[model samples]
Each structure stands twice: as structure tokens, then as C-alpha cells.
Target: METSWEEILEEVSKQIPPKYFTNFIAPLHFVRWEGNQMVVSAPSQIIKSHVEAKYANFLENAAYQIKGDSFRLVLLTDKEESTSHMKDAIENRFQNSEPELNSEYNFETYIVSDCNRLAFTAAKSICEHPGKYNPLYLFGPVGVGKTHLLHAIGNEIKKKDPWKTIRYVDSISFLNEFIFTVRQNNRDSLESFKMRYQSYNVLLFDDIQFLNGGAEKTQEEFFALFNFLYERKRQIVIASDRPSYELPLHDRLKSRFVHGLQADVKEHDLSLRKELLRSYTIQYNIPISEETLEWLAQNCDGDSRALIGIVNDLVLYKKAYQFFLLSDEKIREIANSRLQTNRKRIGFNPDQVIDLVCEKLNVARKDILGKSRKVDFILPRHLCMLLLHEILGLPKAQIGRIFSAQHTTVIHGITKIKEKFSEDKNLFDLYQSIKHQISFQ
Candidate 1:
């Protein structure tokens, strides 16, 4: 099965240039890999037809370029197909566990950056040692490459050993699976499932922090399974949007994660974002000017996903408008269009005009500008002022004037906002939101 994707991909790669490949195809599912031959499968007949009609020549050319003959293509059942393939046949027969996979998520095309070095490194390490970090806890704030890294790792291991035991489950799904197996008088199946993972070379748990403060029984079960695999040196990988220490995990579990490797995914710098945008443009076959790339990097604050979305939108836009290269003015117009199309004032109410003190400290307009400097009220007020002055693009004096305070107060608030960002995910997310909201459409 896995081989199918490779042969076809190789054929497609040779037929179509890298710049145009992404636009021609979506993420693929490898059915098998064997010898010099590969057997890849597509999700649907429609996808198969699209490729056959539009990209068959590219695939054939790619094959010839690679000094190969014809490759096979298997168009599996589409959305209308039965749920049989969705089941984990091996797992069901051996351990009675279902499958958890996202066919669209894989390693062949993940965008890399320093912000995800730790997650990437850990994921790479797991291909070599699956059970070593049993319950390998990957924790970071949201939208910082946790999911992408996790999925890429899963796909890589699967490609290498199609029959190797693998399970990529979101925390909620795992919990539900556990409950299902337990209630059916198949508790034995649950233990067998753990043992199966223990026997497998790899296991990937995405967004594990979602299990924070879950049912005590579930945590206990997970901990036991974790230790079992850790003892055997099997591979385990996990990802969450919070550091282990910050998670509501047991002290023992926290200690275990700390004992292994812990990596923090940072926010992308301007240069990194710019590079990511270029990578996206290249993938989508959308020619973008350097000035436009800089504008996007400086503007989009939600990381690679946000950047890729813009790229995808551009491809769609070009196809619709019959345009070629993206002009700076057009880019800005697209950005504005997206913002207006999907604007959802995340942290603040759009109806309200936050006063300087109120914005700085997250207090009511009346209180921020009021005489009272109560500790509870003061911090929120100062924080709000900082946000408005710094993140929201308001000048210090203007912010202070709104707060009935001096410019010095607004400056202090700005500093505090930076400090808060270091310790608070909510603050960081909001800061990012404000940046994204103000920039691009």
C-alpha cells in the first residue's frame, strides 16, 4: 500500500516541476512500498481522475526522468466508500484497537523552522526509538508546529515500516476508545492494546495536553502503559500546547517528561515567517515578489498555518482571476479581504473603544481612568494600556490620554505586556491575535 504513493509521487515529481506539484495534488496516502516498485493509492476516483487527466503526463515524465517504467495507481473508494479501510485490521485482530490517522498529515512536505526545532528533533529521534520516551510529552502553546510535527513523525515511521504498530490518536479520541473497549466487557482488549503498543516500535499521541485533568482512571492507565514501554525502550511521542510543568499532570508524569527531553517552540521571527511564506508560495506555484513576502511575514502572526493559508488562497485567487504573479497591491488587497471575511475579534469586543488605562489593565473604562489604583484594578489597567500602545498601534501619549494617565504610564504598561507574554499563553495568543487583526485583510 505504501509503495503505491511513492511510485506515483516519484512519477508525479518527475512529470511536474516542484513549483507546480502542490497545485496539482493534495496530500497523499501511501498504500505500500516494496523493492524497486511502489504501489501508491489515492483517496478518491475524482482525485485519481484529476491526476490522470491533468497530471498523468507529468507522472509519466517523472518516471522516465527517474529511469523507471510505468508505476501503478489505485483509486480507492472515495467518501462514499465503506468504513472498512478506516478500521485497524491488524490492531483489531491482534489487540482490538481502532486506527487514528490523518491521511493529509505527513512528513514529505512539513515546513521547518527554528521555532519547532525541539519538536522536529524529537519526532526524528522517535523513528529510531519508538518506545524510549513512552508517553513522550510534547507541550507548547497553540499553533506553534505541535500538530504538524506530530503528524509528520507519524507518517515517516509508517512509511518506513508499513506493518509496524502505530497509533496516532488525539487525546479525546483515545479516551473514547478506552471507554468503548472497557464497557463492552473487552477490558482485556484494552490491556492487549497497551501490550501491542509496547511491542510496536512507535506510538504518537497528538495534543496530549488535552488529557490534562482528565478522568483519574484514564491518567492512571496512560501512566502505567507509559512506564511499560519506557522500560522496554520502545518509542513514544506526544504533543501538547503547554509545557509539562504547566500541565495539570501528575507530579510523577511531570517528572518523567522532565527526565526525558523537553523542547519549547518559540514564536516565529520576521525572517523565519518570510522564509515560510516563500516556501508556501513555491509549494503552491504562486510567484510572489520579495516585497510581498516581507509584507506577509511582517503581517501574519499565527505561524506557518496562517502563511500557507494565504498561499492557498492566492492559488485559488489566481485560478479565478486568471492572474499570474502576485503584485504587492493585490497581495495587500487579498490580505484585507481575508481579514474582513474571517474577522472575529478574539480578545476584545469590537463595539467597545478601550480607554488607555482600561486597555492596559483589562479593566472597565471608568475604573482605568478613575482615581482608584487598587492592586487588582491597577495591573489589568496597566496591561491594557501596554497592549493598546504597543500591539494595537496606538501612540503612548494617546493611550495615556485615554487612561487619564501620563505617557510614562503607557510606557510602563508596554514593558509589562512584554513580561506577561513570557509567562502567559493567553497573553501571547491575544498579542498574536491583535497583530494578525491589525495587519493584512
Candidate 2:
């Protein structure tokens, strides 16, 4: 007897979380089985790629368990199936063709503020007038919207002129393609690789920092391609986690990167976080109150990704529980739980917290951990206790051990900082600043 798709999905659902199954797996439709291959259709290319990359193994395992044999999984989208032969021919001819731009990451969806204004403006300018910035360099910390801007540039340009050739690729993919081309050991293959990249009217490169770390041949090839694109007056956009000067590439490549406009997106501020949260709540239709949103914006640390993730979790939770309204206390509990989970993932130690407090407050380490009751020492000491308890999620007793004080004293110190956070603006700013530094570190 042949196993049905329903049976396979039922088996897979037991292994996957409910939310994941609903969001990713449920949208898939099993088409048919050919010999040892199981065919599936996804609603969109994004879903198809995500399932192939992430959940295909689970599906394969489930099918094996049900059928008592191993079967390969083949995923396709509706659009691909309509022109399968032609698509395959085109792919074979140009194996390194441009990838699909994420439609969700356009400029309109991107949140702009003082934090990312320069990069956003430069990216928009590139869309309006290609090759103007020549090679726009966008650098910032992780999850700070650099990649979004890269895709936005490509999407906007494509929207304006569908005829323009655009290629959006990361450094790793570029290196991998180059490596594959070289292994062919044919001059024609090498020339094809160069021509493919050079043919693009606009190139949006992401995570260029990955090109560092002894990929000298790749760097040389990239330098040659960079010169090709620049001399041809084609547009190029690059994003990295740090500035061009900080990348360990050849000086020539670094100089080329900086010759054009360079902009950076900083970490999200409180207002930015609130705006992001509001956007996400509206996007997902999560029935969160303004007060809860403010609390989340103030308490949730990290980049926009973190904020969006928490909102997603809330959406899932609301759906699972069938709750129409989330109370303030319940929201606080959820936020605290999320913070605790973040604490485990962040792996910040009490010592690092103490070091940051001392450095930021301009007090010596000994003074923080000592019996000093000076006015300056009090604020730093109190701030350190609050951070350890709130940011690190350290228990009062454990934090007390770090300071050689009783648990009650630790509680009092944290309470003092929380009280001052309401009354003292300077202290509140200092606390927020230190927290920001800790988050980036």
C-alpha cells in the first residue's frame, strides 16, 4: 500500500512544532511520487526554498518511516512547474543566474530613522539614479537593515526598469561560484563566469566581509570584476558588518569600496523599537496594547529582528491560546520569559556586566565590588546590580555573591536603580547607554 501525503504530514507534524507546521509545512501540497522521488509544490519560491533548505530532511524522514524506504524530495513552485523545461535549459546555460529578490524587503517596508537615514537615502538615490554612488558601501552591525537596503535597491531598480539586469548575491555565494568555475579547469568556463557577473547592470553584494580570511584568489577575481563594473559605469552596492577600512581585504579592494558613498545603520533606539513593534503588530494583526508595546520596546534588547521575533511569538501564542485580549500582567510575563531566553542565548556573564558598568560610569572595578558608599560609586554599583539582574537574569543571591553583599542588599540596589529610572533622566540615559553597549558587545 502507498502512504498518503496526509499520513506523511501527520508524522512530520508530530516532530515539528505546531507554529512551524502551520506557517511552513501546511502550505505545501504533495504532487506525486516518481520511483524514489517524492514531488511537492510550494505556494511561492520563498516557501519552496525555505522548505528545501530547512524542512526537507524532516519530510524525507517521515516519508521513509511510513513507506519503509528512503525517498528523495523534490520541491517546486507553481511558476516553475509551468515552464519546467525552459527553466531547466536556462539554468543549465547560466548556472549562476541572479537569485530572486525578496519582495518583502523593499524600501517601503524598511523603517527609516536617524539611525539608518544616510544608508536609506543613499540606497534610494541609487534606485533613482543608478551608478551615481557607483559602489555604495553600507556597513553596520548584525540585523541593522544593511541586507534589507541591498535587496531594496535591487527591487526598486527592477520595479522602475524591468529590462535592467540585476544580480543580488552574498560574498559566500560569489566565492562558491568562483570555486566551482575554477574546478572545471576550462578557460571557457572561467570566461563565462566573468561575463556572467560583468553582464549585470546593477550588482548588490551582501556580507562582503566574508570575502576576507585568506580567499586571495577570490579577492583578486572580485577586484577584476569590480574594475569591470566600475569602468563600465554599472551600479554596485555592497553591505558589511563593519567599515571598508576595517575589512581585511587588499588595499585596492578597500579603496574601491570607499571611493563611493559609505553609510551605516546603527542599532535601534527606543523610539525606533517602538515604531518597529507597532509596524509588526499592525502587519501581523497582533492585538497588543500601546502600554504593552511601550514596555516591550523599553525592555526588549537587540536589533529589529529580535523585536519582530518576539512579536511573531506573541502572534503564535495568541492563536494557540485563542485569547482575544492579552492583559498587561500576562504580557509582562511573556516579555520577561522572552528576556530570560535571550539571556541564555546571549551568554553574558556577571563579570562582563560589572566591567561595562565600571567603564561607562568611570569607576574602578574595585570600587564597584568594594564597600564604597560614595555618591558616584552608589549609582554605578546600583546600575551594575540592576543590569546583572535584568540583563543577565542573574539571581539576587548569585549577584549578591558577586558583590559580597546579602541578597536583600542586591534587591535594594536593583530597586533603587528602577526608582531612579523613573525620576532621574540622566541616570536613565546612562543606564540605557550602558545597556546598548552591552547588547552590541
Candidate 3:
């Protein structure tokens, strides 16, 4: 008797956890059998890597139980499909499925600091009583906990009311799905899209600042859905790298975002970073001292993501080296190798940064101070501001005084240069040159 692929997967599910099955295995599609090999498809590369890393053993055991040990298993992402038939099959499989939110992003796991305390409290409050903080606007720099809190809100809401329809989407996914539906041109497909969104009791939209490119159409579509949800008192939460007013949307849309409980997650302070590092150390049961932990927290610039990465790397290094007692030298070596932790210690005054930029870009001190926005002077002026704030750690207000501009203007200049780094090679190279000189100075 021969067994089917579904039967093999069913056996595997019995051995694996339920959450793993639903979040990972359930979305997979068994594509085909190529000679003595079987190929499976996951919706995206992330899913493929996750399934391969965590579920390989269960899959192998299931395959052996169902068929003899002669068969080989292969996994591929939807984009990896070679044939049009496979592409169609994969597309159909991906349709009508919501992107899975990480179960790990619950309130229990989130570490609250003064930096994100208000955002955290507001998230909990909204979950306890939905729609009160309708359109809770969260804004922060990258790798801060904006997205984490967004998912946490969704997870908590679903836990409290299992029957409620909750959806979590980044603006990019929302934009892509809407564009796809519009292109389909089928009335039923468009209606299905409307029904899906309108049915959600809670919608967690992350990185709404990226909600540009197809500004008018997508913005209008989202604005309509937002209005529908808001009118019905369905909870809506949005996270972005900048405030709603800073987003490149119509004033109408921005006004809606501003009407909510707007909160900002600042960069983690030293105490908060120490708390986070200590929490991780305890979780892993690593035998590091308070002194080293404090030193680590003080050395880093309070970026939670970088601090967490260091913790992971330190643990791995400790295990590999089998060090009985970790030393300052060993930790510093690890920091140097893993993080470019050396550049941060070098100090230069804001005046030095301004002087360096002027020399490099062939601009004058008076020109930079004067109210001139010449093509030549603008780059140097922006670079001086950016370098002053980033390198010397000067306050934006202090940097603004150099150019006789408002603090907001200084911020805007830095932001524009940062965004241009991705698209303009000349601008990026100039930034790097200025940065290197400042770092070494």
C-alpha cells in the first residue's frame, strides 16, 4: 500500500507542536514528486528557512514512517518555482491566507523601559478596552519596539476574545495586496478584499511611513477602509518610523492619524539597556557579573537590537571558548570583532565637524552660517549638521544654531541625507568620507 504526502504531513503534525504546525507547516504546499525526490513549497523565503531549521527532524521521521528511506525531500519558496504551472499552484496556495504574527511578541515577553513605557501601557489599555485608543499612533526610529508593541496588542486582543477577527500587516504588504486586487479586475476579488479587511475587529498596521510610491490610490483605498473601521469602533493601531504628520500623505489622512493617542518610543537609555541585557543573561542562565553587564550597557549607544545581538554573540562565544570567567579584555575583543565598537569612543567637537565638512566640500564658515541654500553649500551644511548630531552627540538645537535654521529644519536635512544614502552614490560616498574623517578625528 502507498501513502500520500498529506498522510506523511499528518503524521509529522502529530509529533510537532500545534503552533508550529499552524504557523509553519499548515501553509506549505506539496508541489510534486521529481523522480525519487519530493518538493514542497513555502510562501516566502523566511517561511522556507524557518521550516527547514526547526521542522527538519519531524519531516524526516514522518517521511521514513510513510515511505521507505529511499526518497529525498526538497524545499523551495514560491519565487523559486521554475514552471508556470507551479507558479499558479503556489499563488493559489498563498491567496486568502493572513501573514502569521509572531507568537513570541506577547506582553509577557516584552521588557518595558521608560523609553517605551507609555506606548506599552497604552497598548495594554487598548487590548483591555478596544476602540478607546482607536488608531493608536506609535512612532520611533528603526529597530525600536514599535512593531513589537503593535503585534503584542494584536496578540493580547485575540487572547482576550478568540472570536474577534484580528489582522496584522505592514504598509508594504497592505499596498501590495491592494494593488494585486485592483489588477485582478474581478468584481468578486475586489469584494472579497473589502470583506476581508472590513471583517477585522483589530487591524495592526506597521511602518505606515512606507505607505508611499502609489500615494494617491493606495492612500485613498486605505483611508476608506480606515474610515469604515473607525466609524464602526473597530480598533486600529499603526506604527511608523516618523510621526503621522511627517508621512508623505494627504492632510486628511494625517489628521485622522493625529486624532489618536500618539506615542513615541525613544532610544533605550542606559538603565533600560542594562535591564534588557540583564534579562537576556538571566534567560540564558549565563554567569556574567553585574559589573560586566553594566559596562556592556554603558558602552553601547542604547540600540536594543545591537545590544541583543551582542548578547547572542557573547553567549555563543562563551560556549565555544568554554571560558570559566569572562574578562573585560575578552568582552572588548568580542565587541571589537562583532560590533565596530571602537569608532564610538573617539570624540570630536561640533566645530571640528563643521570645519571638516567645509574643507571637504570646499565651502566657507560664513557661507554655512549665512542663509544661502546653494547646490554646493547645501550638502556641506547638511553633512555638518548630521555629523555634529551623530558624531559629537550635539543636540539638534545646538546644531541648528550653526546654520541659523530651526531645529526641525536641521532634523529634516539629516533625514533627507539619510534617505538619499540608498539612492545617490555620490551623496552616500560623501557621507562616508565625512563620517570616516570625523570618526578618526
Global lDDT scores for all candidate models: 0.64, 0.84, 0.79
- Per-residue lDDT for 108-216 in model 1, tens only? 5555666666667776786666655455567666666677677777777778878876766778877766665565577677776566556655667777776767567
Candidate 3 lDDT over residue span 1-441, tens digit each: 135778887898898888889999888888787776777888988889998888866776777777776566688887776554654653474474678778988898888887889889888889988998788999888887888898898888888899998889998888878877787678998888888899999999998988884567899989999999999999999998887777888888889987669888876766777888888878776667778877676555536787778877778888898876567678767865654542345667667777777787787988876788786777677777778778766555566777788756876888777777768899789888878877886
Error of 1 at 272 (Å): 2.6
Reference-based TM-score of each model: 0.59, 0.63, 0.64
Candidate 3, run of 10 with poorest lDDT: 336-345
lDDT tens string, model 2, 1-441? 245788999999999899999989999987778899998888999899888888999999999988888999999897766666564555474484457899999998998888899899999988888987789999988988898898889999999999999998999988878887787689998998999899999999999999986999999999999999999889999999988888989898899987789998876656778899999988887767888888787677568888888887788778899998767787778767776776644646788888878877788999889998998898899999888866676655567788999766875787688778878999899889888777666
The global Cα lDDT (0 to 1) of model 3 is 0.79
Which of the numbered candidates is closest to the native, going by highest lDDT? 2
| Residue 203 error, candidate 2, Å | 0.4
Query: What's the CA RMSD for each of the models?
Result: 16.9, 16.0, 13.6
TM-score of 1: 0.59
Q: The CA-based lDDT of model 2 is what?
A: 0.84
RMSD of 2: 16.0
